[model samples]
Target: MIEVIGLTKRYGGKTAVDDLSFTVRPGHVTGFLGPNGAGKTTTLRVILGLDAPTAGAVTVDGVPFRTHRRGLHHVGALLDAQQVHGGRSAQAHLAALARSNGIGRRRVGEVLAEVGLADAGHRRIGGFSLGMKQRLGIAAALLGDPPVLMFDEPINGMDPEGVRWVRHLFRSLAAQGRTVFLSSHLMTEMEHTADHLVVIGQGRLIAAEPLRAFADRGTRQRVTVRTPQPAVLAAALTAAGASVDTAPDHLAVRGLSAEQIGALAFANAVELHELATHTTSLEEAFMEITAGHADHLAGSR
Candidate 1:
């Protein structure tokens, strides 16, 4: 588990993360989501003790990460896949990290094969593609076989197969009762991968909740109904306190559920063709919550 309390970071006059407090528990894949400048990376840096917080505290399990006797054996992280020596082979890089952390050199081969990079372990990192570099980075993280994992955009530059493999890997890790925290800007992939979410905007917390609960928090819920007698059904729905809008061949209804709308149509003897509820997607809800929270929004003057 990871615990952060009243976390704040400031660079001179600018605050990057402000009064953030959250706990990432075990047995779940928790996603850290934010726009480009929302301070996701800054918070991760603080968690891993790469950067100190101006105020507040962050701990992995029970103590600050840097204070751990066997730091690499307790937590593993992949902040930047490209932050490795270009001249070194994949095996050499993992070997060096293992030696530094008092880990066994034999673990290097195990993780390389775990990440599907066993054959490429002897190749120079300079010759690897972006996707291969990502795999190599993951191999390094797992070299410790740590219980806690933190990754920043692990799927970046990955092909479809690689992306799918990563999704499954996260799930498998969490199922083993490990803590998995990943930061990403890809909402679609997150929707399928994360069990919980921590959303931030402009250096503050927007929401921290389960994925299903967060998506259901969307304010706009509508029921779509198709009927030949649109006018009659619309009148009945309006009388029941529902706002209705006309589409090409259906009525878009607010303030009601699909079952409610269907029952109203049936009581009014209206012929119904189709009835479905349209709940907001994760991307739509994310955009709505962070509407004006972006530090750098793109637009033409």
Candidate 2:
């Protein structure tokens, strides 16, 4: 588990992260989300002891990450796939990390195969594509088989197959009772992969909650109803304080639950062929919640 308590980071006069507090528990894949310049990278750096926090504390398990001798055995992270040495082979890179961390040489081969880079392990990283580089990075992160894993945009540049594989891998890791924390800009992927979410904007916490709950915070709850008697249903829904958008074949309703709508329809003797509730998507919810927190906004054309 990872604990961040009132974390704050400032660079000279500019603050990056401010008074952020959240706990990433074990046995769940928690997504870290924020708009550009929202201080996500800064927070990650502080947690890993790469940068010092101006205030507050971060700990992996019960202690700071810097206190661990063989850090890889406790926490594995992939901050930047492009930060590796391009001149070295993938196998060589993992071997170096293994040696430094007192890990066995045999683990190198295991992680390479685990990440589907066994065949390409001997190839120099300079010749690898972005997707291949990401795979190599993932292989490195798993070399120690750490119980806590943190990935920043691990699926960037991956092919569809690779992306799917990564999604399953994160879920599988979390199922094994490990702590998996990921940061990605892909909302659809987060929706499918994460059980919990930590969302921040402008260096402050916007929300830290379960994925379903966060999505439920969206501004609108709409229900789509297809009925033969659209006008009758519309009138009934409007009378019940629902805002209805009428089409020739359907009515989009707000401010009422599907059960309530059905009950109202029954009371008015309106025959309903379809009644489906349309909750907000993760992307839609994020946009709505962070509408005022964006750092840069494009002007109207």
Scored by TM-score, the top model is 1
* Candidate 2, superposed: residue stretches over 4 Å from native: 227-232, 269-273, 296-301
- Candidate 2 residues 1-301, lDDT tens each? 9999999888776888889999999999999998888888888888899999999999999899999999999999999999999999999999999999999999999999999998998999999999999998888889889999999999999999999999999999999999999999999999999999999987889999999899988758899999989988888888889999988779999999999999999999999999999878899999999888887222200
Candidate 1 global TM-score? 0.93
Please provide the root mean square deviation of candidate 2 (C-alpha atoms, Å): 3.2
Clashing pairs in 1: none
Off by over 4 Å in 1: 295-301
Alpha-carbon shift of residue 214 in model 2 (angstroms): 1.5
The positional error of residue 184 in candidate 1, measured at the CA in angstroms, is 1.3
By lDDT, the best candidate is: 2
**lDDT at position 236, candidate 2:** 83
